[model samples]
Target: MKPLHLERCLRTVEADKAVLCSAARVPYYPLVVKKARGSWVEDADGNRYIDFLASAAAVNVGHCHPRVVEAVREQAEAFMSYTAVYMYHEPLVCLSEALCRITPGNFPKRVIYGLSGSDANDGAIKLARWTTGRSKIVAFQRSYHGSTYGALSLSSLSLPMRRRMGPFLPEVYHFPYPDTFRPPFSGTDEEIADYHLDLIRRAFADYIPGEEVAAVIIEPIQGDAGILVPPVSFMKGLRSLCNDHGILLIAEEVQQGFGRTGKWFGIEHFGIVPDAVILGKALGSGLPLSAIVAREDLMADWDAPAHCFTHAGNAVCCAAAYASVQVIEEEGLIARSEEMGNYLMERFRALQDSYPLIGDVRGKGLSIGVDLVKDGKTRERHGEAAAKICYQAWQKGLLLSFFSGSVLRIQPPLVITREEADRALEIIEEAMRDFLAGRISDEVLKTVKGW
Candidate 1:
């Protein structure tokens, strides 16, 4: 593919296409991708990039993973789609069993399927409300679940995401989620925990009664909201409160599940078992598939056609998801993620020593973020600077993404080797240093901002 072909593709997109919305936070970097494998992606002009963003984390097992491709291809040959809502499907049952074996919870559990994170979230929350017979729900500020109406109502990540999408689900309340680097409330970890926990306790009296709240939905590692990770104390506080009030707890792991966070689930790091877990993105290794795994009693009563998606439980996707699980386990990608994440963070912190603009480097496992700021003390969000880093990174054959503005997000595929991690990190450091030395162009800086 030539540069002209790439330019033509870009023009065709703008002229012939109309997009209702998007979650990608950076300006579109124009390089028509031709193929990808493992952690490397080749664009139209044959420029290869270390895929740090991993296609919004959908291909965690790596692009065109042989096992996943084989599974989907084999399933497609026999049958493509099946309505599990009506008849039996072996792949669906096998995938359910696999998830049941992996997902937390000692009691009897069941799996409910959907086509995306948003729909799974809706199903999980609806189940919580129905089973518990409560109406109100609680979500955190700067949290993102999905784009659908019910999930959007619970999302506090972006006001633009909810703008003009009026009359969202009632009683969907929001509270500030704690962050270590940003420090939403100033103090030590204990003090931070106490301050945020007190707010939740007060919400019962001031905002909405705790008794009326059906569930408290949260991401163990906040994804779209700059990869924010709350303190363990805060997580335990929520768990205790849920237990005390008989409210259900649902952990939305759409972005953080399936070894993306070094563990089977991000919630595992916190050492608390949620009543339900929402999974998507990497489950089918690039295919669209999401599921809500919960206690048997909670989901055993959800009858079919009550909540139906025509493509839900598609045989090929289920087969792919099952293979993805096997591939992750057989290949030891989970352990690899843990090892590479620590190495990546260490490299980032080393880079931070030379770059003051890199104010904070924090993450567990592969979901890491480098928060750029004007100054360490003032902590003014330098979104432009971060975007400039992304601009330079793309030019240097590295795909980087950021959200909201300040935090440079790095969610590479789990199958990425130390060599790939080092390559991407070197590009990141090189890009940052170049930007600092005034090598970044004014046009690039201008376009990277206010997107």
Candidate 2:
């Protein structure tokens, strides 16, 4: 079959049989992408899309970046795999050294590699438990760490992601996320911070002992749930609380790391150094690589052989990650992300002024989110409406992701130019306007909407 025909056939079959995620069958603009380069993807239908989603925040330096491609190619030609067990390779060592240099804090650090965000979180959990000789873990509600059993247990999202997946790994606890837009504590940022910290203190008194709590894992800037940026004092308070309780703080930077949030690591923005940092997604520029970087002393407890994986430090993946980091650093992508983020936020605020449905617009760097509501006063979630906006954007040759039902997340590649960003914003505005004007029927719009 011809490629286009093949894609159509595959999509048709997938629609019928695939038990897909909420966004999967929502009128896919084009079923297949033939190639991608420099912030755009060409579909099998001969249409091009500006990749605002960046393959769900993996292609930070742009899709198929030349340096990363070259690194992968070079490693593949020479050697593809080396067991981290018997022998060592240059790529793994160099990548670890580079990570030490870039990760926050002045303390000596150690690195552990994994294949994806889920595995990285798994490794982090083990490291925390082993180092502390404790079993309890604390996470926040509506936070998404990963989907594996271990990571999923640590995550506190709604059902199907965790429902009937129990009895989940025991002793994992959840706290309310610090959402300023919809404060779970019902007060100002400072009051919210105090309330959250008090809740943690109460948790120690009522549930897990503070000394037995392995770690308090959090996303510096919550993704998936929404681009929820906690107040600076809230984060610092959490850090201080962790220190006081003698619990390790693990910052999950899986989505917000690697210049996505205009910082080397999202935790850096809060000026707090976590005991361990979980990184993935953009680390390998779309290749599968994730890591746990922590203080050398903390990781030393995992000296035994049982803690390692067979493909822990795959050379090709490490090489790709090293090259991706180099591009982000040498090209000044962090600063660029900050600048583009500010420009996009400004545009979003302008949209907010004109559209009452835009209840919130918040984030840092290239990661931004617009939460839709029926009315700003009520803040009733317009999940269906947000999904329609995303579908319309996709139809207009711009790809974005929907999160937490009502949030339309805009996370373009760091390599996205100001011109490209403007074009994307234009498409978003057109979609929002069309949806608001009732140009599309409620039935069609509802089909695209997930609510």
Model 2: runs farther than 4 Å from truth? 1-30, 442-451
- Tell me the tens digit of each residue's lDDT in model 2 across 92-134: 9999999999998899999988888998988888888888989
Instruction: Report the number of clashing residue pairs per model.
Output: 0, 0
| Top candidate when judged by TM-score against the true structure | 1
RMSD to native for every prediction? Answer: 2.4, 3.2
Give the clashing pairs for model 2: none
lDDT, candidate 1, at 128: 79
Candidate 2 deviation (Cα RMSD): 3.2
CA displacement after TM-score superposition, residue 130 of candidate 2 (Å): 0.6
Question: What would the TM-scores of all predictions be?
Answer: 0.95, 0.94
Question: On a 0 to 100 scale, what is the lDDT of residue 237 in model 1?
Answer: 85
The lowest-lDDT stretch of 10 consecutive residues in candidate 1 is: 1-10
